[model samples]
Target: MSTTHQPTPATARPVGPPTKHQLAVMIWVAVFPTLTVLNLALGDWLGTLTPVVRTFVLATIAVPIVIYGLMPQLHKLRVRLLSRA
Candidate 1:
């Protein structure tokens, strides 16, 4: 006798790491707010620098905060949420 394969249901929870598109969204979600808040808080101080220098400084600071500080927390949240499914 032959067996038939069944497709996963639409509501099925996904396993494994996020897809490329999902990762992009997660990065954007982490980066936008961090950059906005930093820019608002440091606007006056950063104003003295040229555009390129300002961008460089912002990126340098933002990268660490996003990667080290925020990404871990976000990943935890994702895992918790997915686990509930």
Candidate 2:
């Protein structure tokens, strides 16, 4: 049996780390819509809490959503976009 190893294609290779600006843009894209929707949906309930408590709640909720949920999707999008370029 013969084994042949072909070079990896561009699409097969993993993308490098994002630049600072790219990371910032990705984070902003993920965070803005998330915070906006969360605020709109929870505004009435959150408004009843003190300012600090409301902020704390929002951050707690937003952090998980941004980190675990939206960020992964955003990273995938970034990779796809870069690959297409």
Candidate 3:
């Protein structure tokens, strides 16, 4: 009689790609309405501002906020992807 252990496949972990159902729900919940609202709202607000002011405001507020918000997550993802490759 013998005892043995086998490693599970990496895919066995409940990480990585979203399922089809999850992707569909994510699109409905996050993508569709946000895109429509952003386009409508930003179009109106940008139209109200002069082009130089619009550029300045967007650069001052939106760009920094977006970069700060996204950079850590993007760095983590980059490390993970590069390690995998």
Candidate 4:
């Protein structure tokens, strides 16, 4: 007697990791905020010279905001990937 096995089609495959573009976006989304906070801390510690420079420096807070917004989504993605393995 012989046994045979078959695999499902591509469309049947489970959705997994974020695509390359999504991964890139995710990384940028995560990193931007962290970098922003870093920039702000540096600016404050070093004391930027002008109002325009300060405004730009303050904009670094957006890094945490962006990251906070994405945390849930990233967490969800992480859980899905881990469970699959």
Candidate 5:
């Protein structure tokens, strides 16, 4: 008996990393809402910190949410949209 392998369909394939412009857009999309929420949630607490420290704190909170949370969902959306076309 012989077996033949079939190529995967485009819709079933994994998407690649974003291009530079796409990455810029993703960062813009992710960062804006992250910063807004962080500011609303911790504005008073962060006010006493130095500017650098405040920036660091905001990044620490935002990076994980963007990288692990928001980026993945956006990527899935991108894949879905592209597959539909």
Candidate 6:
């Protein structure tokens, strides 16, 4: 009896880390929705603050949600998408 090992298909290989451009695109995609929701939910309250304060508040709120919440899901989605293609 002989045993032969076949190489895995490309699609079966583990996906690599995202490139800088991919990361940038993911960030942009994450930010657009985050901003939209934040604006709708807090536009009136945030409007009360000065521009700098408003930006700071938005960044504070949006960054974590994007980095921790949205980004991982997006990365998974990206991996699924690339694997299909």
lDDT of each: 0.87, 0.90, 0.55, 0.64, 0.86, 0.92
TM-score of each: 0.78, 0.82, 0.48, 0.39, 0.78, 0.82
**Residues 1-85, model 2: lDDT tens digits:** 8786543585367789899999999899989998899999999999999999999999999999999999898889989887656
Off by over 4 Å in 6: 1-11
> With candidate 4 superimposed using the best TM-score fit, by how many Å does residue 82's alpha carbon deviate from the native?
15
Which sections of candidate 3 miss by over 4 Å?
Answer: 1-40
Maximum-lDDT candidate: 6
| Candidate 1 local lDDT, 10-82, one digit each (tens) | 7556567877887898899999999999999999999999999999999999999999999888888877677
Clashing pairs in 4: 33-63
As for model 5, its CA RMSD to the true structure in angstroms is 6.5
RMSD of each: 7.5, 5.6, 9.4, 9.1, 6.5, 5.1
Q: What is the lDDT of candidate 2?
A: 0.90
Best-to-worst ranking by lDDT:
6, 2, 1, 5, 4, 3
Model 6 Cα shift for residue 59 (angstroms): 0.8
> Which pairs of residues have clashing backbones in candidate 2?
none
> Residues 1-85, candidate 3, lDDT per residue (tens digit)?
6665433565333345555775565445543454455546687787788989876755565445445654445445645654454
Residue 18, model 2: Cα distance from true site in angstroms: 0.7
Q: Candidate 1 — which pairs collide?
A: none
Angstrom error of the Cα, residue 2, model 1: value is: 36
